[model samples]
Target: MISGRRQKKLGVRTLDIAKRLLDYGFHPPTIYFPLNVEECMMIEPTETESKETLDEFIEAMIQIAKEAEENPEIVQEAPHTTVVKRLDETKAARKPVLRYRKREAQKQ
Candidate 1:
């Protein structure tokens, strides 16, 4: 349960996060909006990096998964490895920023 202000703050934080994701060489993961549901974040390093990079990514993912399972808080505190920080995900969705142009603009 959060207010619009808190949600906006989280949204800004998430936006900052999404920006860094762009540097990953792959697009950022899809973010839902105006709908309220738990979000899923994913990263398939193969989509963006070389074999060596992907291997490093896989290793990190494996380690992260293990740590997250061992202590869920670790993952919750993740995105830390990233430029972004953990946030109330629900807030992220209620408000979002679109990377692509507006649908109407695209159709024009």
Candidate 2:
């Protein structure tokens, strides 16, 4: 349970960290809920994960912290190695393109 406020000035956003985690082949933890804490990240390792796996996750988090300090932009724009890039959530919600239509269909 690590809250991101400790390094907020460095532009360390919880969403950015979560996105970066995807690059390391791990799912992002639940973030920014339970309003008592700001930019909260709850990482609960289940019994299914071995010790080595937990260690790997810790190492990845450390690396991400370093990257955030040295190259903040990288952390800000995460998921660089993924197939699809980030999306504008507000825009998507406001103007959603749910289905596709051919040009001929529109003309008819």
lDDT winner: 2
lDDT of 2 by residue, 26-87 (tens): 99999987678888999989999999999999999999988989998888898888998988
Tell me the number of clashing residue pairs for each predicted model: 0, 0
Candidate 2, run of 10 with poorest lDDT:
3-12
For 40-106, candidate 1 gives per-residue lDDT tens digits of: 3444344656888767544644554444345544334445544555556587788765586668868
lDDT of each: 0.45, 0.88
Clashing residue pairs, backbone N/CA/C < 3 A, model 1: none
Clashing pairs in 2: none
* Per-candidate TM-score against the hidden true structure: 0.40, 0.84
Instruction: TM-score for candidate 2, please give it.
Output: 0.84
lDDT score for residue 84 of model 2: 84
Stretches off by above 4 angstroms in model 2 are: 99-108
Superposed on all Cα atoms, the candidates' RMSDs to the truth, in angstroms, are 11.2, 4.9
